[model samples]
Target: MKPHKLPFENRWSNGEHGWQWHCELERLGLMNVRAMFADHETRHPGKRAVIFDIPGGFVRDWLAFHDRRTARQQFLWRAIVIGLTLVTAVGTVLNLLRL
Candidate 1:
């Protein structure tokens, strides 16, 4: 297998973060920079300032978006949990009646 050059080999060694493509998303206030950082953490943890060393304000914005997304996920999870609980309760009642 041929080895590939890392994304930050020559140019960004001594430069700032290069998440310009996400600038538009940031401007729109729809981009979750924290989720972006989390993705980087999960995918490429030990690579310079890909996640941790970003500006505090940018990180904050990302975190806010992440929180919002997480809330939505929590709502969905609660719905699923309630549905399962009801199903189990009904099944148990049916079995007890048969016994």
Candidate 2:
């Protein structure tokens, strides 16, 4: 976990075929996972027919995007919780001094 590595960037290579082709995978770090799968169809030409038939690869990409989204949502929730706690603490002190 490098200091600058985003969470998804860290987990991106933990999946199948990820570690073996880490460089190529890293190139896709900024792309929406769906775009990567669509581009794969071009690189592997004949593989398209089978890929469209099953769509497992596309599903994997969606899952990655969804997981990343969920992580972001959790982070926001945590921030909100901390903010509310601080506000409550300040308000409590202010109320006590006025009494």
Candidate 3:
């Protein structure tokens, strides 16, 4: 593996309480970004930031499912913003031409 030459501590071994959980997920090619921000203790004592145990067989599917939702949300938001910007630009141009 290539060494990360960054001038700071390794992220995978940071002091964060849930660092181990995210490290395991990265090894399995899955991620729960939300957990990296804030995590709370659960009623099920053993469970940490991951909340659910993702079996090896479902890791790929879980990644796909999670990433797809993120993509769809970002696409919708960007499309709306771009469409609104275009409409405003065209309206301004037309108004200027009328003057």
Candidate 4:
């Protein structure tokens, strides 16, 4: 299978179509994989094509980084929510005691 080509110039140009172009490229790669698998099946019986060869630590590291970032954001939001709730509860208690 030929390597997929990327539109580097357009991607780096800060254009809105960068994501659209990426999706198109992904679709094209999938189509190519289907075609390659079909050809492989005809030529070799009972064998599967290895379409992707990812490094061992890549996915794990990516997930760990994503989890850390997500946790940080969640902590920030939770702190803000808790602070607001505490303030509201305190205000209610003070108003009731004064009445």
Q: Which stretches of candidate 2 lie over 4 Å from their true place?
A: 1-52
Steric clash pairs (candidate 4): none
Off by over 4 Å in 3: 1-54
lDDT of 2 by residue, 1-99 (tens): 322322344333344444334333444553544575666566764563322342434435544756789799999999999999999999999999999
lDDT of 3 by residue, 1-99 (tens): 433332222333334423443445556443343342223223333443243543322333344555777798999999999999999999999999999
Relative to the true structure, candidate 4 reaches a TM of 0.46
lDDT for 65 (candidate 2): 59
1 or 4, which is superior by lDDT? Answer: 1
Each prediction's whole-model lDDT (CA): 0.56, 0.54, 0.49, 0.50
Q: For model 2, what is the alpha-carbon lDDT of residue 46?
A: 55
Query: Best candidate per lDDT, number?
Result: 1
Q: TM-score for each prediction?
A: 0.41, 0.43, 0.46, 0.46
lDDT per residue as tens, model 4, 1-99: 444443332213234433343444355554564465455556753443222432213222333444576799999999999999999999999999999
Error of 4 at 63 (Å): 0.6
Candidate 3 similarity to native, TM-score = 0.46
What TM-score does candidate 1 reach? 0.41
User: By TM-score, how accurate is candidate 2?
Assistant: 0.43
Candidate 4 — worst ten consecutive residues by lDDT sum?
A: 53-62
Sort every candidate by TM-score, greatest first: 3, 4, 2, 1
